[model samples]
Target: MIYAGLDVGSRTIKLVIFDTVVKESLITETGANPLRRCREILAGRKLRRLVVTGYGRHLVASTQGGKVVSEIRAFAVGARYLLPDCQGVIDIGGQDCKVVRLSMEGDVLKFEMNDRCAAGTGKFLEVMAHTLEADIGAIGDLALTASRKITINSLCTVFAESEVVSLIGRGEETAAIALALHEAIATRVATMARRVGIKGKAVFAGGASLNRCLVRLLGEKLGIELTVPDSPQLVGALGAALLAKHEDGQ
Candidate 1:
């Protein structure tokens, strides 16, 4: 029997299927109708149990039957499963950022979240990448090659976008500007993590965690050796899947 977990995130719809014989996950754009996209993804799947989590958890739960878990709890469970010694989780999603402190048993002890603005989330990077006329996937690698570290003073997405554009017009290197954006986000997220008192063995999970430059900068700013799951973006879904299995007594 397969246990499925659906994570309806702001920018992506992630699905994970777990069972005694196999473990798999899939990612798709959330698009205009997330519930419809999710239905299409699970069209023919046979699930013994289902669990939903993330920003759109309630929406998915209302249209589908599943246990609901907070993103904080889901990340903690997913972190522990991937990094057995994990004590903290930093998840930077499309529109929000979360710093979760976890217990040895995978319970969420404490967490700090930034949901009011897009300054330190994936959307921030997306906008920066667009301003620089660069691909989001390549921005991280490009940032790593910067010879000088530039500072992005603005904390607002709109101002930051304008700043990036101005810098480009002033002949600033794209690489340096990209790194600055990552650094800015890392600093903001690190501050939030410190508020919860970061512990040892921290993990970075979420779509933004896929940015190598951001992950490195975040580790440096937090002064912690951060680890990323093979599929960081799927961590929440994986956690939900694990929850479904337990809920089903499978």
Candidate 2:
């Protein structure tokens, strides 16, 4: 059967097409407007099942024929599919960060989210990248090369931008500042994880998890190793696809 999953996140839309009989999946990403993008992607295909998840899941569901699942549940299902033993999941998206503790059966036990601010999110890193005139893809490598460490105290994106400018004027190296930015984001995520009681065998998913520097910083702050799926950004979509199959069998 051809199963499809769509995750309508704030900054991007992720789509996954899975062939259950063949046990294969094709993943794709598009800018916002998930409903339109999803229709565009599945236009010519015959979808036996469809499921939606993420920030704009409701809109996607309204436009498309599918059940909308919570982002936390979708992420946990995706993480568990990737790492069957994972007990916790940390997903940092463009505008929010979530820490979800999952049960052995892949159900959410507890969850915490930071959605009130852009701090500790992918948007924060994007702003920092713009401040340093650095490419978002290159920031991680640059941060890894930093010889000195700098501390960024402001968790608010606006104040942090001002702080970044001041540090630049003070002759602080860009690499150090980049590392500091990752550290700051990691600290906020770590604080959120603590509230939900992060456990070992933790899995990290989402587009932000693609940054190795941020992953390393998070590992240090959480004081434990974190497992990342092969395609971190597709986890939510993957979970949605899996759920679609499960519902069909019900």
Highest TM-score model number? 1
State how far residue 182 of model 1 sits from its true place (Å). Answer: 1.1
- In order of appearance, the predictions have TM-scores of 0.96, 0.94
**lDDT measured at residue 231 in model 2 versus the true structure, 0 to 100:** 83
In model 2, how large is the Cα lDDT of residue 131?
97
Displacement of residue 150 (Cα, Å) in model 2 is 1.6
TM-score of model 1 vs. true structure: 0.96
* lDDT value, candidate 1, whole model: 0.89
What tens-digit string does per-residue lDDT give for candidate 2 at 8-70? 888878877776532445455556556677777767878788899988888778877889988
The per-residue C-alpha lDDT of model 2 at residue 245 equals 84
Alpha carbon deviation, residue 166, candidate 2 (Å): 0.5
